[model samples]
Target: MAVQDSPPVPPNVATTGGKLTGSLGVGSIVFMVVAAAAPLTVISGTVPLGIAAGNGAAFPATYVVCTAILLLFAVGFTSMARHVPGAGAFYTYVERGLGRPVGLGTAFLALLSYTAVQGAVFGYIGAAVNDFVVSHGGPSVPWWVWSVGALAVVGVLGYRHIELSGKVLGILLVCEVGIVIVVDVAVMVQGGDAGMSTAMLSPGEFLSGAPGIAMIFALAGYIGFEATAIFRDEARDPARTIPRATYLSLVLIGGFYTISSWSVVSAWGDEGAITAATDNPEGMVVDTAARYVGAFTGDLVQVLLITSLFAALLSFHNVLSRYIFSLGNTAVLPKQCGRSHPKHSSPHVASVVQVATAGLLIGVSALAGLDPVTEVFAWFAGVSTVGIVALMLMTSVAVLVFFRRSRVDDRLWNTVIAPAAGLVGLAVMLYMTAANLPLLVGGSSTLAAVITVVLVATFLVGVALAVVRPPATVVEVTTQEEKK
Candidate 1:
């Protein structure tokens, strides 16, 4: 059933008391979402791995395929935003369509996915900072030390006005995108190693050599794009801004990934790219920069990579804090987490909790002597990819059901056709991701199994909590209402 024009609520409960407020326009929201994608990190880190371990030179095509699926998903997703506007995003949409328990479960899964990704970035950035410092003749500080320092910086930004975070992300995103584009142009202009070729775009090549693994990495790059709706409460003219930002974020992210990855393949010569990536996945992108542009450009890219990671951290901090804030406001979490800062109108309490939680994860990982990049980053990021893809699949189905039952906005394409197409596409992605989890998490089947169990358990725990203590704010829509 459609959301009630006015749902009844208890007098003591205050829905608007701790409400978050801001005036973020489409540009600001796009920056926040795209920055979280961390273009430099994806190109310099994830792309090489995808080429080596996945479909080789054809890995670039995966982005094109994923973009198509998600654009279809966005059709229904943005349409829902016009009706069910809230900070909860997927949680709100799923609840309005499905039911309270499933919606709560989706929220828990979203939290797990976003938090895991932020933790993964923390691990990666820590290692990157430590390496950069030692390379420049500085004392070799531990990676965790750098991670904690970065956490403190992000914590401060997340506690302030959202526009401040947006502005910072915008600056960092431009620099990172600029450097990659420069390298791409330089490689293209020089005719690449064996001249530019389009053979990599062929369907046969895309299906070559563990394509499922390639699909996982490609989808991971677009993780933050779907979070556009999480900022609904802060958006200026959300009905317009949210949809515009959603489509724009996908186009920019997808286009950059597709072209930049093709340029990287060209830099190595299409035939030899796989071997190069396999030999030196970490340094392939940087070395390419030095070769095509100049040594100084390589150094500049390394610095920008650090900033890109920091941007991702800050953007995710904002997204995760709002999810917590939404839960708090709905009474699923402690009400203190619902409170916005009186001055900044930010979700300061939830922001603080998110920082503490991330810090705790970093500490535990360090104490356990886990390799930050291999174990901490790989494992957490792998889990996040699986969780997010699953959430999207569920959301696609939710959109179809909501529109059909409620008879809200009966446009055939937006409500029925597009959501159905997206659902099928996402279902395939979820299966591929699940099947190849071992590769994504560093080739450990046992660890992959454990991650699967944890994800399932987390979603179930949310379902159980909802069953035991139904959230007061979650009104149950009846069959009679659907008939209305």
Candidate 2:
């Protein structure tokens, strides 16, 4: 099929009235993406579950493997970043390499994935905070009540300038990560049952429990790494900054998860780690902290876990806002949403819409009387992972196609080899995701099928729109940047 005709865009059109400010550096961008991954939450919450349900002692290796796969994916991903310019990340790359129709379809998937994951975080944080409050003699309140309150706070932050959000994320990310690092160190120094060793990293251990399930868990932690490109327009020196941020985030996030998880395995000893995780998955990290660190530190971790969820919520909020803003810019959404805030240089309209959508989802989920973690969080997370994996596979293919035609760079590694490798790797992961969908989402075949159908339906709707809707007509606007 022929590529759909996109409206003519002027050279200066990208810098027109709605442009977000270019003040974020590599640090800022990395912080946002990594925070979206929510290091503490994963290490404390998911790691235990992964160990129990997946490859016990070798779970840390899963992170390493995920990092390698993404680094390979990034070879083509960042390569395309040099040629394509936009805040749409996968949407822009796919459109450039694939076609306008496919690009628009990918955009829909992007929105679905990010929104689902963000809503999942909201559900988790709501239930967590509600429990925390009641445990401390606070007023008894519904989980959705906390969720709505959080939505209000996040909406205010999202409506402000991008830097403000970045700074807030930075602080939260540091606290969450710092506490985990401290706990990891304490565990190592104390040498619980087994002293530190390279045993967990071994292939034998890595492949031990259900590796497929472990891989799924590991992939979820790296969900937001691709957001590096989404922030390209708002980042300083897009070409240099985006690529650096992508690599930096993968290394930092991957390294942190691997090392922290290894510490967990070491604390209980390989033989007993699995049993410990199985017995009390929820307390794996908390119990470790209390044992090695102190009771006070364990309490601190519980508090930080809530903050970690908040960081993820805000980070995803920013991501979804930008996706809407970019779609608006291309006429896929309301023109008003295409406009940036005159004073804050933020996607205020899009942010408001995101908050509203989140509120609706939260409300519906509450009305259904579903368990926050089991139904709301698990189901949404499963769908989001599938969508994200599909997008990654498509984008990797786009990278190869774009380079083959344009020959933008002469290096075979950058243009062809890496993209091909990434394509294969992502294709495998995509299969794993699909195969293990039920396991990822609480083992309900019906729930998994429902989520899968939703994702497929969303993509079809995008395709139908691409086929039926008239092509967008590009318009020029005078360039302007609001002062910081």
Candidate 3:
């Protein structure tokens, strides 16, 4: 017996809207970058410790360095993007630069990591929405509903114009940045709390909690910048626009995070900065703003924080869905995933599938008797961080290899040394995330070990499916007989 070709819609797969045009300008790309980072500013993995370890005035410096590192990687990464346009940013980069097997594995890894991020953000936003509703005398609905609601909206938008998504992201992002800026200015103008300390500038504190820790936090601010190449097709000009957006997004987000992180420290006064953050890391930024601007402003900031998260959900959903579409384009995934909407020119079908999957995941988590806040951070968010770090390293290698042949341009520095160095940094971060999983989950290392295993298992399943190969489409187009 031979395997039969199937025509049924495959599970966990969908058709994609084909390649997007390079019309996205520097501004839209900038929005995606901020949209990715806005949520991190408020809902940090370990906000309390940030003030103590490299989160003070020096935080900006740390971000500056990380941004430079990513920009360096982009120097080579973008050069390669000009040569290849696909939805799988990392996978496309690696496969074209490395080999098909590596690309296949990269795609699998990317789906796990980025999709987990999408689910993770849903959990966070769900909790926030639930809390807000209950506090306002509304019925205390479960977090699952919020997650499902967000998934639906993302699906609707994902089926439309990339420009529209960018516009929506831009509006929310501008608001987020505005709020952070308001708080930062208030803190500075009010002269901060009691005794001010320039000690934040000292590198001594940067290494207090293992030199790797500071570097690890710094890396968080750079994660989404790698997607610039992924947006090449949608970019206005792949040759120019994508690279400009790549470097520009990195600097803005990096500089913003560093400035805001330090602002929180200054607002508390160095003496209580760490203690206050430890006491209420998530709420500390709110409190810091309240201390200077009063309760009204603080509460307002919290509300905006909720909105900021929604923006993040929208952003990651786009990235995750695009990867799905890219998979289809490469034939590792269903042909449907490679399609583009005739009107919207986006991956409409892939977006719908992604939304449905995200909804199912949040529902499952809610039923599992888990704490949405902490558990989601540990199980999904932490895993995504580890995955992103690993992919960054791979992308760096891809860049180095892809450009290895072109000696005419100074590929040595842009393509080789700089990205190679970045790979080293990201590898260190991956190791730290694994070793300190407990820290990421707000649990003991023992528990973290178990959680790490779960994440790895999830990734393995994705890889297994890819290796097995999904049933691909066999589309047949019929045309009128040629008029002889």
Candidate 4:
């Protein structure tokens, strides 16, 4: 069987036309990727929900498990990154390994997932902003107002050079991580409520409650880490930078979630943690901070929570814009969408489109009288989780098939064993995500079924589009010179 690869770039094309450019090093890329994971938001919002509704004290262990699985996925992912090129990370890889139609379908799905998550964050940040202002005796403002305001700011940043967004994200990431680390240290010094028990790490504890639910929530926190490759066009020395950033992101996100969640558990005592989480899921993290650190830290956490969501919004905006630019450059969409701003060397057209789409989603949700946090945030976020995990599963299979057929990088672990293992893990995660869609989307089985149908239809539409109007050939840059 013949193997497929993306078409190479023509020698005559100029750098400022269709290509994106930046001076992003490993640290900058890592900041963008990790910031998208939104550490503070996950620690405060998702952690309590995982504990109360998931496996109670053992929730932290779920992050450990998720991190290990994603690291396995990264082995083949980064290996392919060195050889396969383009901003269409998952889409490009799938096209290279599979054929164009399936790859195009994956592309559409990727767009949907990233767009959904970005909208979800918009809803969340709006609510965060509204709450902070009203609680401080400011005028009562609607959440959508704040969301739209954020959309404008993100749009402006995304339409500029990539380094600007990277720098901004780096600052926000440091502040959020710093606050969480402060609380973690305080918990350690004070010896926790139950004297720092490690029972959460026990296998038996992992299975105590709704472990499936716990797994899904934990997995959600790691959403944006895989986006490291999407910045390949902007990174300096991408072959080395992409892989290093990928590994560093996974390690940092995993370690932070695991240790911080454990501290939350310890602050309340194993038994008390579950009760507190159940009673006040929203206030669980904030109150824990107040108790362990100080009331001042708790207030600061609240403020930083909004910034954390803003960082995530900016990161996903950049990711989605690049995806659009890639598809456009390949003739999957209008050629103009692929064009970069000559002055900024950024994907200006695609960035504008992304911002417009998000704004439209927010507008429609508001017009329909939907609750920004519950309906918009929870529902869309659930859809994104399901969509992205499905993509990862597909990408893992593509990696295995690509390596086996092409005889490229024939090392057993990178080419075969790791992708296979990651495939199984991701497949399980997809199953859990799909099965618990009702719980994820606020317990409407009918709504969950609707989400599933919509996703399947979106993918089929992409496949049909590819068949009817095939994408133009795209450039594929390889790490090594061809063997004679």
Candidate 5:
């Protein structure tokens, strides 16, 4: 079927093999969870620590708040996705729904966010590995080793077919989720040493911290959902599968974070929860497991933590590469960027670009004498949040615009109102991020903060370029062979 009526839908679009099928059932949904949630491997104790230092037991409640907000955002985001199917995600949504200028702006920002996210994961994986190495007392490998290792692994998987990447990710997802459930259940069985506390629900708990810190970190857990469209070509039913993945990802993340946070609180004994979390955020789960379960089991959880972060790196690489590929497909990029690997059926050139950029950034940071964890996680993540925040704002607006112009009244619920709410919610998060940019990256590292600033400025520059000279008209990307 030709995309005659749908401007955003390319003409001559086909049910292409390269495109993800919509059979995205529970397994696909679960793969998303694995990608998005595994990053919590590094986030778990870290978020609670920020809370302990700032909020308290109430940190768990904050996770729930983000869950609701993201759910609202998904309503709009997914609603738009149904009409506009591409790996560019928010960028495509805003471009078609809004104006080209706005669309390109969103696209550029998303590129920043996705690429920065990949960069951020590099540091995170390095840190996870470093943690493991240091714990072993074998004179921990420099963080660069972790970065290199991640590059090698992510590069290899990305060089192959999506299914191979999916399989590897599926295994990691299962293991990570298994560990998270194991920790939560183990804590529950052990019971609270001092009973449940009211702090889990108190507003005062969240208000106590520089609210920005908690909100920003909480936002980190939601990053992988941006990849929802990455599987579009593989989903069973694009229209249905994409929307379901959107909602499923949001709900699963929110619930998973909530339960995990509460389990930590329960393990700590109400009053001491946050403080204990602060003293040892990365170690909190480990300590909790050791306390309630056994040393052997706690050690196992720590090992899985490394695997979880690695899984996150792998997932984000795939997401970012596809984004690159999408940009190339539109001829908005270098012709080479859009080319798929003839042998592997992968976006080889784009994949290499992502790996190279990540390596260069990580390597330079390490050589320049900086902590990869702080530089990678705080700097790139904070910047990406800002960029994604912009996407959220544009997406929310696009939802309203698309429905406003189109005869599609079905979108009033999911596409219009809910997305509007999400936009508002994300805007609040962005305000918080800007106000507390320094704090997001520890507010302590001048270098990290500087790096973030430069990145944001560069994004603006790209937006400026798109304004000066817009990209050529998008042509039919799929072919007759693809339709067959």
Candidate 6:
């Protein structure tokens, strides 16, 4: 039976009343995406955890494996970038390939995932800043105070202009990356405790002892790189910029993670690294800095960790705002959120909503006297990881089906084979995430199940919305006629 083709929408349709204005080239986009990953923050916080609880010295290899899978995912991901240039990104791609209901559901999932993760950062950053100040004999306020203030600052940037956010992220990202690189270089020059052996990258190390956990942490680090397509409206020559940025960001993120992690393992001697991490997971990197470089540099890295979290928060705010704007433009959300700043050409309304939503959550957590890192950050970050992995799996399949149905490209690897490969890897990761749900979200089975149910229910709500109030017109890839 021949599949009937859906009518394609006009190419480059301005769904939002006002288009986002920016000339963000590859470098700008890379900074935005990688900043969301927050290198120094991840190394100082997440890496030690991975080393201690995950695969030990082999943790560095997990990043390489994750990177390889994502690179496969990106093969079809970047291919679809040329076909669907909408800011909706996964939503647009899935809707065009699958259907409106699924697309709408994916959008809901995307919003929940990005917002949750962004909110998670606030919890951690607030705590970090509060500790920094109190330990330094400064005024002591509740962590939520810092979280709310940081939210306000990012809210302003997100509401203003893409270039402003880009420049801000650029400066923060450089400092964060530079500081980590300095530590890495220092470790290398000293030849580490184990004399700089390549054993960390060995196959035995990579395959040994619960590598799945390490891979989860590694995958979380690379989450924001996929947002490259979400900025299509503001990209300069998106067809070229998006693909280049996608690959560039992936490579840079992967290489940086691999090297930094390996250096850390070497710093303590690959054998003792796991013990060092286990002993003091939080301050392993800082302590290593003090020992390897100098006490001053160690203090500097601690300070940079706060800025790293801030950079990540701002980057995520931009992404979540765009997601809200895309839904609003499609009438899935309030029309007000669809409006952009006339002068700044940014998603001001959605940005405001982002800030308001985050503030409300912070207020609730504060009132409840919840631990920001354990209760707020852990739960949201875990759920977001699950949601994102699911989205990636859907997107990989969407790429394959879309290309097959449209027959727009005759190439096999770009459309079919690579996506198939990517889907398999993503599915495995999704399964691993679900299996480790309790561990990911504070080790409470009941809590994990509740969060899982919420994720499922969020998608169902989106599906119901699509059925109850259908879009006046469904958006799809441009047909030959529409393109012309």
| lDDT tens per residue, model 1, 385-468 | 999998998889889998999886989999999999999999999999999999888889999999999999999888898899
lDDT of 6: 0.86
How many pairs collide in each candidate, listed in order?
A: 0, 0, 16, 0, 16, 0
TM-scores for every candidate against the unseen true structure: 0.95, 0.95, 0.87, 0.96, 0.90, 0.95
Q: Write the per-residue lDDT of candidate 5 for residues 1-484, one digit (tens) a residue.
A: 4442212332222322123222445466558545755745634645566566546677777788888888888777777676665667777777777766666666667777777777777777787778777878867778788789878988998878777777787787777778777778877876776765567677776687666667777777777675776667656666777777777777777788878777878888777776677677667777777887778876688777777777777787877787777766654566567677766667888889888988888888788877766666767777777777767777788878887887556746775678778878888987887667777677666754675666567656656766786565555444222354
Which numbered prediction scores highest in lDDT against the true structure?
4
Give the per-residue lDDT digits (tens) of candidate 4, residues 1-484: 2222373343323542888888789999999999999999999999999999999999999999999999999999999876776668998898888877888889999999998999899989999999999889999788999999999999999999999999999999999999999999999999999788686779999998999999999998999898999998888878889999999999999999999999999999999999999999889889999998888876798999999999999999999999998887777888788889999999999999998999899999889888888888999999999999999998998899889898969699999999999999999999999999999988999999999998988888888988998455444444321221
Candidate 2 residue lDDT tens string, 1-484? 1222232232333555567775899999999999999999898778988889998888888898889999999989998887666678998889888987888889899999999998899889988898888878899788899889889999999999989989999999999999988888888888767787466658887788799899989899999899998887788878788999999999999999999999988888886888999998878898988888888877788899999999999999999999898877777777667778878989899999999999999999999997888878888998899999999999998888888888868899988888888889889899999999988888889988988889888887877787887556655432112111
Overall local distance difference test of candidate 5: 0.70
Off by over 4 Å in 2: 1-16, 474-484
Write the residue-wise lDDT of candidate 3 on 416-458 in tens digits: 7777877776666678767666666676777667656765665
Model 2 whole-model lDDT (C-alpha atoms): 0.86
The lDDT-based order of candidates, best leading, equals 4, 1, 6, 2, 5, 3
* Candidate 2 C-alpha error for residue 41, in Å: 0.6
Q: What is the lDDT of residue 339 in candidate 4?
A: 88
Better of 3 and 5 by TM-score: 5
- For each candidate, the alpha-carbon lDDT, in order, equals 0.88, 0.86, 0.69, 0.89, 0.70, 0.86
Question: Model 3 segments beyond 4 Å from truth?
Answer: 1-17, 43-46, 52-61, 194-197, 405-409, 444-447, 450-484
Looking at model 1, report the run of 10 residues with the lowest lDDT sum: 4-13
Lowest lDDT sum, 10 consecutive residues, model 2, at: 475-484
Q: Candidate 4: what lDDT? A: 0.89
Cα displacement (angstroms), candidate 2, residue 64, comes to 0.6
